[model samples]
Target: MRGPARASYRPVTQRLEVTFLPGLGEIVADEIVERLAPARPPRPVPGREDALLVDHAGRLERALSLRTAVAVFLVLTFDVPRPKSLTSGEHLPRIADAMATSVRLGAARTFRFEAAGHDSSVFQRLAAELAHATGLVHDDAEGEVVVRFRRTPRNAPQPGATRAPTDQAGWDVLVRLGGRPLSARPWRVADFPGAVNATIAAAIVRLVGTQADDRVANLMCGSGTLLIERLLAGPAATAVGVDIDPDAVRATQENLVAAGCAGRATVTRADVTAAGGSWRDAGPFDLVLADPPWGALHGSHVTNPALHADLLRVAHEVGAPGAHLVVLTHEIKVMERCIREADAHWRVRAELRVFAKGHHPRIYVLEHV
Candidate 1:
């Protein structure tokens, strides 16, 4: 056998933590490892499914460009004395000094603080201490620095009547590596009721693996998140979005304009289910993505079965040979039943459960053959 290839040299790594929606830490880790090629792959923090730590050797800007994490934080671990051993008067200055040093290093003029697993009294004390040390004016509305403090043991019981902290472990102070959360994309200028999160939308687009110059379509495209994400991903030959609701169509159109992709993407007020033979001329799309209504709310859940059936029928009509259809929804049972009963020429290629907002939505990638 040939000699093993040598590993390329990488820069010194820094410990960084990425926060994602719960249940998606592994996906985020995979993304980090694939994109950043960290010296050490990301591993979930103990007892916290929402956070993962990685020793990244690449530029922070590159990590930020990944767009998978909600917020990336630079961790500062400080060992504290015993519980109640040091009150705000004694310990507050030290904590503030550390945070202030972090801010100085970060070079931000303003900051904000949030205390977890603590009541109002503790929250106030910590916030007050940080404010004093950093001398960075606290601007909760739009602070450049997002300083978060948490119990060292991680998810230890909050000091409350029901449960109390027995011992005081040191604390981990996380300073946000960026000014704004990565989930808040600048392209999302318009909003709708069920607009998908930008990060989730990006992830779905990545999973679909659309090709440059490929014809793409988004059925039931609410607010045009998927279409915009596709356009942002690469130069598609044609991007089409259809929504039956006029408001959704208008909103998506406005968003496309805001994203400066009006020429590259088009949104029409037409129902995907009713496209029927009318869209036959739209020329079998190579990739079809949809974020149909999941009916999770009180009024919309009942009509999902019909919606799922109609989606399959429309997908069958529009999908090109070897095309892919990616769907994000929370109604697994209805979608699975519809898939089983569909007369369409498609099979589930991959599936993942992702946490979105307060709901856990499943993304299914179906390949048309």
Candidate 2:
């Protein structure tokens, strides 16, 4: 049997758009610069929230491998007066050419569009034209080439006034470049109820600034996201995950093995709140990581403070002096109070607010004082 074809971004030197989880622009840019070097750094797109622009001149596979962003789009713009015009102009051929360059779209048997009033006659006509032009079936709901069509912003507008439409500065058509979204991680073999998104996990790992020789501990490690991302991000002297639930422990172990980092990491079925010496057998860690239960899914508001405090106790017990404690959670006040009261043992270093799955969460970075 033969394997699937590999994606070759035949064209170099193109302007790409990036839409990422909010509050992660700088981190995403850093991820890009660090991996795809000499390609200009990702810069925030004006008037667009959670969007960035990158002028890339390298293989497209490198961009598709980016972990921190939600989607990367090959940009196409037209100055036509209305949506219908997109079907008639030189735009049609250009759109087809752009689609041909994308490995997903070129090989797809069908295509689809995401746009305002997609069911309208204009869009229906446009879809028909594109199908004829590209010889791909139009399967509105299940198209492999997911097209996002919107009005390119002409200017910053007043609050109540509607922003300009396609009749203004024309339309922008974006085709996602990756064969699949980056967050749809293939290594996720098991899932937990409160498991973090892979992109968020990648961001959290990047925030810690992984090093080659650091010893790491993941507390309350539900699915071993931090542990897997930690080991994948860079080399670590030792990495272990501890959880109170045997189910969670198993989930972490399964995911670690799927990620192919099991040999370099360990998952323990132990309560983090227990005496540090119990698990401290591995020695003090350079970084302690956690994504504790928030009120919604894994825990309740009434008990989070104590839970947060216990997590702190475990961090103090396991972390070496000046080691870092990175926690990602939505239980802000309770977590803040715990850290504030434990001021003698910790210092707040940074706070990052991010959006995911219709909820806002903050990552707190602290130092073991």
Candidate 3:
């Protein structure tokens, strides 16, 4: 006689909402699969591709380590007809539990609601209830934990749908785990006028693929974003950044020490476009990263094409045969012209266009031939 099969009991899977820049959802998903290796690879939320729903169990400390994520939230779904129902129903305890988990895992002390129309009385009422239930102060100004409520987008209307005209479901309560957004790099002590986002920089490094013994170089390294991200991504044989601006050089130097990237990289005040600079002969680099000004902020458009041409010459001089050059820029026409002009020396390999807020920046991977 065979014994009856025992039913295996599994705990509830914690759903994490990992948000990033709009165009980077796919990259962020791949990173989660590589780093976290969750039970199932993360899937993008419907109608909100910028955010992914990650199913992870138990503690959430490891999930917060994702460099490409802007913020990680512990999501809880509540079935209430109206927003006001949450203030009276069984949702308070559940929210308190989520808050406890967030505080425990993230070591947070305060909480705040990050929602549109947050100044409305409904949000204020909900905030008051959460403070009472969680025993945590609700500090709107400097709160460490951010709680957000979003409606789950459904294709079809539910049997008892009562809200808006479009199909809608219950509220998804998202409690952010950390004191600050992950995009705010701790090592960024200095700021550049048009500095690229840290998460985008991380994505660039990931897409380029790092090697242990690769020699890395950054031209026009404003605020050292690409250099620091590369050093953090993996072990490099040697890394160096050069900029004509003394302030940029100083900022990079400051960030190098702050980021614990001192032994891995060096920063110098030298013109990358000039053939006579000391940094010109220090190359034969395996990887070259560039984030040049796009005429809008730092450099003007009138001379940008010539400047980009000079940049190509400098990279060609220092790059090893078949070396890869990864470039991020918004000056599309100028870069297109320069790449065409330098066709004999370089060839385009891959290109990815990503959105950062309202700005559209294109990333190009080129091979020095």
Candidate 4:
């Protein structure tokens, strides 16, 4: 006689509530729904108003309730990249004014202004002006302040790079501004790297919502910046990142190890265009997130319109039905056509314009409808 057979520990899906930050609303919701749909088993709908009842794996549950859930919960902070034409004196006031307007327009609740590529005195002056305009008490040591407004509740302000000191935890995403300077590139063009702009990145992440146990994958993973940030923003299903560039793969691997997420995340070199190639050998994934190369930036060498189409086709083939495909692209016509031609049903969930230098980059939230 033997003891009872050891129980196999299968993962179970749980009900989750998702709130997209201010600008991300329906686009993020649609993306989240699409990503989770294939993994969900068909189940009878539950009676609910303003709530999306979804079948998670084998479990029936409500994932998001517009009425009950706080729709926009996350706030983003960004440091302005120094402009090529501006001197220290001119730059500080311009950034300070921008920050004030950003807060006034409700883009952020609070912000930490930092001086990059210049002396600390510039940042101090900007901070002082921000303090005066917003009626925020300044903390010189931490380089932050609190904004006072009628709508802001007593416990609203939280201390951090992005939020007021009183803001609650569990922010779906957070972004730090300032771009990495590329080697062999001039300072002006090197300001913005492939990593999405900080504010825009946070907005997109909030749009995607958060899942405690959702399996997520990033194809064409660049520096693994998004993956690293996602790991830090916890309660994910699981994460896997792949890049065609071996150097990017190596960097991602090193970053994961350094961030203590090597156990939960993996990075590998895999060409997305290869036929029948699959990341499933890694594990079943729930979400496919990517910032595919923009044709405009890479020109004809790396990413072109044809390559975009091929990538979308491959993404559809590898992705589970109803999985959300969130992508950032500057070429609108190219992406629109690619999605139209792909096998998976795709709908534009959200769109945003990211200004870099003089160009405006478009971020698209595509859903596998």
Q: Lowest summed lDDT over 10 consecutive residues: which window, candidate 4?
A: 178-187
Q: How far out, in Å, is residue 102 in model 3?
A: 3.1
User: Which runs in model 2 stand beyond 4 Å of their true positions?
Assistant: 1-11, 37-41, 104-108, 157-168, 276-278
Predicted candidate 4 versus true structure: per-residue lDDT over 209-291, tens digit per residue: 66787778888877666665566556676788888877677777776676677788877778777864556565445567777
User: For residues 1-369, could you state the per-residue lDDT of candidate 2 as single tens digits?
Assistant: 989998976656777898899888889988888876745667766567798888888877677878888888888888876778888767899887766666552336677888989889988998898888888788898887778887776564545767633325777889877456777777888999889888888998888788888999999999988888888888999888989889999999999989989899878888788764456777599999999998777778888889999889878877899999999989888888898899999899989999887899999999999
Weakest 10 consecutive residues of candidate 1 by summed lDDT: 80-89
Candidate 3: where are CA atoms >4 Å away? 1-12, 105-108, 156-166
lDDT by residue for model 3 over 212-307, one digit each (tens)? 989899999999999999999889988989998998889888888999998878788987886577675667899999999888779888888888
User: What local lDDT score does residue 354 receive in model 2, on the 0 to 100 scale?
Assistant: 93
Please give the CA lDDT of all the candidate structures. 0.76, 0.83, 0.86, 0.51
* Shift of residue 54 alpha carbon in model 4, Å: 35
Best by lDDT: 3
User: CA shift at 223, candidate 2, in angstroms?
Assistant: 1.1
Structure candidate 1, residue pairs in collision: none
Indicate the TM-score of model 1: 0.81
Cα RMSD for predicted model 4: 16.8
